[model samples]
Target: MTGPTVSSPHEVTDLAAVTLLVHDRTRRVLGAFLGREQTVAGAARETGLDLRVVHRDVQALRRAGLLRVTREQARAGRPVKMYRAHADDLFVDARHLPQQAGEGQAAALDPLFHHAVAREFRRALSDFSPGWGLRVYATPDAPGFAVLEGPRSARRLSPLDEWQGPPARMLSGTPTAHLTTAQVTEVQRDLILLMRKVAEFSAANAGAGQPVLLRLGLAPLTEDELRNLHR
Candidate 1:
């Protein structure tokens, strides 16, 4: 049988809609409905979320116009409402969002990205074997390694005590420094060049390497945060 028909990408321009779509749970609920119609219970089961939580997220998504009730399914107690995503994908246009709202949206979306990276790392660790090692080159200047002899080696690793994974390449770092505005601008330009080079390399060697997710971010520290660093 054919699957449910999904419309093309939906363009979301409303600030409220953008805010709602960036929320982690709302995104997950909408994902569960994309390309298929599903009841709240089905979404809950697929996402492994609580039934009440899924229902609440669905209602919020519906109100945001990101989801729609497609049909009703006959069930034992009552007719179950089947929901589908309004489109197969969402294209958010926040170019005109107010400064404060844009910042709020970024803050709301940051954790979701972090969670994705953490989840991938955990999954990689699940297949870990003895004598495996993890090497992280946070930056060209600083490198770190966590070698695992076996499961029992966890106790000697301190902060990385719980880390166990096959040989892998990873980059992560949060380096704070004081810099002039011009220096920061130069660094930003270099970062852009680095991103372009990475993209070009990936395109040139498309099928040779496994998929990897890369996230890059830069921001100045708040005055309060900087002050705390000295204490």
Candidate 2:
């Protein structure tokens, strides 16, 4: 009796993250069980795939280095294999992260992940926030961070929907100038969605805390504006 294999939403997203070289449902399914523990029957049930099908996918993922048998058991006159997600094979953390251990690991995978996330976010905006503008910006001076600015006119933002996991702030700034209630709320919100979405891509789910998004607000000041604001 082989333990079951299971798939998770996080696993599904991981496959999408590193799909540049390969895109197969089996690989994705197998990646789900690599580092994490799972039983074959459980994985079959979770992924809504047949036991035989899941087994095949697991085998395929092993060959790809996306999955490996972490453990095995014997019961009912047969041996059962337990699958764990292989660290090397996973491409994305549900937190929008790579499995690498470090601060700002997301930055390491940014060139690739950023484009994909931006594209998904843009597509999401079309239906979720029609008429809203999403801009992707990176400054040489701003290292280990990525920012997405929505149209200044947008309303409240909800990170629960936007971010795949919890997000936390690394650094935050206050808006130098007082903004209208709508502007204030909108800026505060969309900023949260974008950053929190980015934060979750780290090590949170794997003993990392539940994803928390960090919100930063800045009001860029002109020379004269700065004088007035200070006064």
Candidate 3:
């Protein structure tokens, strides 16, 4: 779906440009290179798209201000230009979005929080070893959190316990809704408190133990996914 066409001429113009990038093929190209830098040939290889097609889309995305030249490779013939999706994510204003009061506030805040997290996560990945891996948390009971842990490259497929000694990890709550809203709030508050304590402990014990990139997030679950889970 396209974003809302608004009053400002510039906003309308910008929306049109962004809508083009949301086309199927262009979207595929963007997804293929979203988190990593790649040459046109490399992107084509990754997406199984024709090189000429990738070349055209990449230029279009560049002009639309979605992709950027990350760097170039000195190939035998021409300097191979490397491109990457600079837009970590996109936000489109939908007029039909649920109009419940405060939904707009939450909608606006969501991207700011998420993109900030993405920026930090990318920074951590770039600096950490390759064995680290992404861990996702979800439940039907409440909003879930995702944590990134490390010592090795996240790109590796090893299980958490196998690599280094067991780091301080905790998981709780169930996929069923047995608790009241107050109970859920209490659990969330407790989790945050525990994490704060851990931060204090971590700061005091920094460098004395195995180094790891620790993170946590709590976000709403998609109703559609929860429905699928029941099946």
Candidate 4:
């Protein structure tokens, strides 16, 4: 039997749908079905999730209109249902949600975001190789940073046993700057524009390069929060 019609770039505006999509497990189940049909058992295998968890996620996704049963296969006792995503891409819009709902979305996403960042950092360190540097530059329009790969000849040439430790080191620092309201707004605008450009670049280079994670965060601290930093 033919499945329901699938589309590209599904626009998700329902609050229920948005809530489901924010979850990592639901996304994993939906991803397993995207561009292909799969049974609950099959999705569990592909995602390495428990069968019961996959079943629950699939049901939730179907109810959210993010998934559809494509067909049913006749088996010995019952028919096994096949499922597929409603669209290859999903664009979730939560701007219309109430303040409480928006906060809930953020709370749901916070752990997943941090987990992804941490996973990528661990992966990078595991595959760490020497010979890279960060280049910071500022043009009249904006300031930016780039990770520059050093030449192979300049890379670690010593034998493993001769080295004292891993030559690569992580670069990170947290510096707080006090600014006027207008200055804060300007910085936020610049960060938004930078994120947009990064998104465009990722789309342009999709499927052509190694996977990389880029995360940006900007937040203003309250007086109490700022004071707590010292204690």
Number of the top-ranking candidate, with lDDT as the measure: 1
Best by TM-score: 4
Clashing pairs in 1: none
TM-score of every candidate relative to the true structure:
0.44, 0.31, 0.35, 0.46
**Which window of ten consecutive residues has the lowest lDDT sum in model 2?**
164-173
The alpha-carbon lDDT assigned to residue 15 of candidate 4 equals 77
Model 4 CA lDDT for position 20: 78
Evaluated at residue 228, the lDDT of candidate 3 is 75
Give each model's clash number: 0, 33, 9, 0
CA lDDT scores, all candidates in order:
0.74, 0.57, 0.64, 0.72
Residue-level lDDT tens digits of model 2 in 111-161: 554455565555655554234445454445658444554433434446642
Q: Write the per-residue lDDT of candidate 3 for residues 1-231, one digit (tens) a residue.
A: 999975432222365456655466888888877778888888889889999998988888888877889888897998988888766656545552234535666777767655665665556556654434656544455556445444443343356443432232322223444466787788789879978897888899976875444344444456786687689
Q: Work out candidate 2's RMSD over C-alphas.
A: 17.2
Higher-ranked by TM-score: 1 or 3? 1
lDDT of 1 by residue, 19-95 (tens): 77767777787899999999999999999999998998888888888889999989799898999998877887667
Candidate 1 accuracy as TM-score: 0.44
| Order by lDDT, highest first | 1, 4, 3, 2
Off by over 4 Å in 1: 1-8, 96-231
